[model samples]
Target: MDTIGHHYIVEAAGCDPNVIGDANKIREIFLEAAKRGNMEVKASYFFKFSPMGVSGVVIVAESHISVHTWPEKGYAALDVYTCGENADPEKAVDYILEQFKAQYAHVSEIKRGIEEEDRTFTHTILTWEERLDRRNGKP
Candidate 1:
């Protein structure tokens, strides 16, 4: 189907708190993820919270990748959106999860700006979960 963009909404759990709490590391991770996903990075910024947490965004030519973290809960929320044909949001998401060492993740993908025959626009959503630490064939 033809659409304007792909947006990935992700919830990652069982991650390393330290990794997610570090703003500098997250900025680095996001930049690398943009490269890994074949995205053209225009600019980026990240902020670290007192106590424990972080928030950040990487703006790309196609769209952007953003994240928020709760270190105390070992959880993170991420959004990867892109409209360019050359951009791979999935690859970027995967890299982010791997870098955070997430043991489990729930991902929802939305096909945005779906134009109908009547010139209307709509979106489609698909959701799934991954058990990244499936040791001994068990999640």
Candidate 2:
């Protein structure tokens, strides 16, 4: 089956609190990630919560990359979706994990718009966990 796009869902734990709490920083990181993924930037928006955390999105020609952070919990959730062969969604995901300094991450990749023989559209998913850094007593 052929997929029209790739969607990466990420659960990043033990991230840097300062990085995730700053809306400006997160916006910068997301834009850079999109560029590295071979995506063309369309528009972007970010918001800072009352006391903590940040939420942002970078809309790209291929698709979009978005994130929400929980500074108190040292956690972040991200979605990287891209269409067409030219873009690599994984690159964006990797950049995010690196910039956040995540100690552990659980990632899921969904192949979107998969066409079946009967002309019905469906999706396939693959998931894995990555121990990005070992210093923080992560399991």
Worst lDDT run of 10 residues, candidate 1, spans 130-139
Candidate 1 lDDT, 82-111, residue by residue in tens:
996888999999899888888899999999
Could you give candidate 2's per-residue lDDT for residues 44-89 as a string of tens digits?
9999998998989999985889999999999999999999989988
Model 1 misplacement above 4 A: 1-3, 134-139
Give the clashing residue pairs of candidate 2, or none: none
